[model samples]
Target: MSTATNANELKITRVYDAPVRAVWEAWTDPAQVAQWWGPRGFTITTHSKDLRPGGHWSYTMHGPDGTDYENKTLYYEVEECARLVYDHGGNDDRPPLFRVTVLFSESDGKTTMDMTMTLPSPEAAAETAKFIKKAGGNGTWDRLAEYIDKTQSGRESFFITRSFRAPIDVLFAMWTEPGHFSQWLAPAGFTMEFHDADIRPGGSTFYSMTNGQLTMYGRAEYQEIEKPSRIVYTQQFCDEQGNVSRHPLAPVWPETMRTEVLFTSEGPNETRVTVRWEPCGEVKPEEIEVFKQARGGMTQGWTGSFDKLEAKIAGSQE
Candidate 1:
C-alpha cells in the first residue's frame, strides 16, 4: 500500500501584445523582466536570474507605497519557445510555493499563454486568489498577458519604446562614457555635470545639477552594463560631493534609491529608453505617501527634458 500527497491549484490565462518570441524573451531576459513584471505601481529589481532547471531567480518587488517584497523561485523546467515551469513558493520561504507551468502557443501571428499553478495546500490556493495584488497566481497570469502586447520574435526589448529623438548611435555612445553624459541628461531646464562618471559594472558616478536654485545632487552605482543596450544602476539623492545622502527636505526619504535605465534602438535614427526606480533604504508609510504624490511632478520634469533632447537631436543633424 502507498500513501498519496495531494496539492491545490490555481489557473489563469492572459493574451499578450507580443509574439511568442518576444513574450519568451521578456520572461527570460533580466532587463525585459524588470520592465513589466510588477502591477499597477510596482517595479522589479532582479538580484539573480539564472533561467535553468534547478536554478533560482531572486528579486525584490518595489511597491508604489515604497514597500519592498523580496521573493525567490526555483526553475523546474524550460522548453525553449514552448513552455516554462517552476516551483514558486519553492522560490521563497513562503508556505505555499507550488509548481507553476506556463504554455506559449501562437494564434494569428500572436502568442497566447496559459498558466497553471498547483499549490501545496488549499490554504495556499486561497491565498493566491485572495491576494490579487501581490503576484498571487492570478496576478502573475495577468502580468503575462500584459507582456505579450509589446513583444515579438526578432524584435528589440520593450524599454526602447519609451521614445527618443536622437540618432540611435549617438544616444548609445552618450551612455557609454561620462563626458558625453554631462550634456543634456536632465529633465529640461536642468542638466547634469558629472564630477566623476565611472560607468561600468561595479563602478559609480557622482554628479551635480542646477535646476533653478533647486539644485540636487545624484549618485548612481552600476549593477550591470551592457553597452549600447542596457545600463542598470542604483540612484540616490546625494550631497554636493555626489555621495549618497538623505534628501535635504525630507529626512524620512529612503537612504538610497535603485533605478535601472535601459536604452533600445528602433531604427538607425530612433531609440527607446525606459527608466525604473525603487527605494533601497527603509520606507515609512508617511514618506511613501508623500513620494507617491510627488511622482507626477518628477514625470513632468523628465518629459520636458526629453522634449528638449528631441530638438537638440534634430538641430544637430540638420
Candidate 2:
C-alpha cells in the first residue's frame, strides 16, 4: 500500500472532534458508512461489503436529483483503526475509477483522517475533479460528523471508550473507592471535595468541584454495582446541603442523568472501559437543547479526566 500522496492525486484531510476508534469504525463498517458515505441528500444501499484484504464492497448511491450511481471497491489492505487501501470504481463491467488510501491518526483525543485518491491519469483526475466539486464532497464529511455525534439514534447519550494499562479490578477499585476516585475523576483545572461517598448499590455520593473561582456540587445515587464489570448511577446537580438543584452554569440543563460504565479485560494487565451518559427523568425541551449544546464540552471534560486517570494508573503501578 502506498503511504505517500502524489501531487496529481486528489487529497482531502479532516480532523474530526471525535475519538480514533469511533472515526475508524464509521469509515470501515458498512452499516455505519451507509449513513453518510454519499453526497448531500443522497442515500446509500449496500449490496455487499467485506473489510478484509482482497474482499469486495458493492453499493448503490441514490442522489437527491433522482440519479443512481453504482460503486464497488476492492480492498487491497486493511489495518484495524489505522489504514485502508482500496480501489474503487463503477460496477457491472464498467471501467475502474481510482485507488484510494485513507489513514487514521489520533492526537489529544481527536481523530484526523487523510484520504488520497489517485486517478489512472491526469485526464481522469481532471474529469473526476469536476464531478467531486459538483457533488459537494465537503457536505459528505459534515454528514459524517453528524452521524458520529448522533450515534445512539435520537438519544442524547455521550459514549466514550478507552483502554488502560491496568487490570480490570484495579481500574474498578480506582473508580469506585472514594479517595482514588476523587483524585482523577474531576476534569482538568478542577478539584473535587467529597462530602460523602457510599460505594455500594443503593448508596449515594455528594461532592463539590471547584475551579478556583467557581464551585459546582453534584450528587449521585448508585443504582447497580457489579465488581470489575459495570456500574449504574443516577447523577444530579445539588447544593452544599445536597438539595437537588439546577446546574449553576446551565440552569436549563437536565437535573438528572443516568450514567453506566462497563469495564472489560483485554489482557492480564489491560482493560477497556466504556462510559455512557444519558439525561433521565422529565426532560424539558429547553433542557434537551442545553444537553445537546453541552455535548462537545462534556466530551472534552471526560477526555481530560481520563487522561489524568491514565497517568494515575501508571504512577500506582510504579
The local distance difference test score of model 1 is 0.65
lDDT minimum window of 10 residues, candidate 2: 1-10
Segments in model 1 whose C-alpha atoms lie over 4 Å from true places: 1-161
User: For model 1, how does the per-residue alpha-carbon lDDT over 1-318 read when each residue is reduced to its tens digit?
Assistant: 001123366554444556688778878998888866765457889999888887889988888789988888778888987989987643445643567788998787677666777776878766765575233223333344434433433222121113455665777676666765776578677777888877889998888887778888888888987777777777788878666677777787666666566665544666756555545556666666565555445555555665566666677779
Query: How does residue 240 of candidate 1 score in lDDT?
Result: 82
**Candidate 1 TM-score to native:** 0.49
TM-scores for every candidate against the unseen true structure: 0.49, 0.60
Clashing pairs in 2: none
Per-prediction count of colliding residue pairs?
12, 0
lDDT tens per residue, model 2, 172-271: 9988999999998998999997899998999999999998999999999999999989999999999888899988988888989998888877668878
Task: Please report, in order, the local distance difference test score of every candidate based on alpha carbons.
Answer: 0.65, 0.80
- Which prediction has the highest TM-score against the true structure? 2
